[model samples]
Target: MKKFLIIAVMALSLGAYAQVDPTFEKEGDKVKATYFHANGEKSQEGYFLNEKLEGEWKMFNEKGEKIAMGNYENGVRTGTWLFWEGDVKSEVSFDNNRIASVSKAGKKDPVVSNK
Candidate 1:
């Protein structure tokens, strides 16, 4: 039963990932995209084509401010991901076609725990 449950979960996850837009266009190329999220208000919206993200995508905050932007390949975060608060830019970094390094601006601030 446990093994069956694991397979079921994997299948469902893969299904959603495979559920991409079949009619999406990319100017000259025959790219596609699937809306992983709805309304594009909260959470985050994802686009996929050729089973990869081939255009500019945005992930906004609850206040409707863009927090991340840039190119995306497949399901992994690749290229530059610029973070901002409305017009107040925050952090930005480059990704090596895979989610790895994440560099912030300047010095790292100290953390305070309220134990």
Candidate 2:
């Protein structure tokens, strides 16, 4: 009976530790990151913050397409966000409490401009 109780306690302890927490792993420990799921699929992914995402986060679609990747400013997206698709990339700059600009660099700058 004592052995059985000890085994049960050990199992419970391990289970608790396996749960995601801010202390999930050390700074350099090799461990898989945590993620958020939507519609039965992994959609929003981010690093842990007290077991939650505190800084930046990335969201994706079911087809493995990136939808949005931006800062989670203390667990909430607060700054400009960048999005990408196939061969396109764009950034929505935020400044003075407004969108400063949307810069899209479609191609590399020419070494020399045509007159």
Candidate 3:
């Protein structure tokens, strides 16, 4: 009986960690999306244009800490992206979805032009 109870508890715990499907809302021509972690915490939010990722996107970890932020132009990564891990912050530049360069800084760094 104890073994059966333990198995049931484990199943419940696994179910609790199952990720929820992302939600989408249509706003004019853009579709706003919100994705959540298995813990029911928001993991990311962004917009889609013509079924393609577009506009500003922000991501957070399961602990609800901002992990990355950047922009996608017509599904292609563009502009500057910022990532955080521990005490280190990384700046990544992208052009047409290709990484142009990356740098580390203590504070929010300015956007690096691909030119």
Highest TM-score model number: 3
Task: Please provide, for model 2 over 1-115, each residue's C-alpha lDDT reduced to its tens digit, 9 standing for 90 to 100.
Answer: 9999999999988775553332234354222254534334456666655544455667777676787787654344457888876567788765543677787756466799889
Evaluate all candidate structures by whole-model CA lDDT and list the values in order. Answer: 0.58, 0.62, 0.94
lDDT value for candidate 1?
0.58
On TM-score, the stronger of 1 and 3 is 3
In terms of TM-score, which candidate is stronger, 2 or 3?
3
Writing each residue's lDDT as its tens digit, candidate 3 over 1-115 gives 9999999999999998797899999999999999999988899999999999999999999999999999999899999999999878999999878999999977655589676
Better of 2 and 3 by lDDT: 3
Cα deviation of 52, candidate 2, in Å: 8.3
Candidate 2 TM-score, true structure as reference? 0.45
Put the candidates in TM-score order, highest first.
3, 2, 1
Model 2 lDDT vs. the true structure? 0.62
Off by over 4 Å in 2: 1-40, 47-53, 95-98, 107-115
Q: What lDDT is obtained when candidate 3 is compared to the true structure?
A: 0.94
Q: If both were scored by TM-score, which would come out higher, candidate 1 or candidate 2?
A: 2
- Measured against the true structure, the TM-scores of the candidates, in listed sequence, are 0.41, 0.45, 0.84
Better of 1 and 2 by lDDT: 2
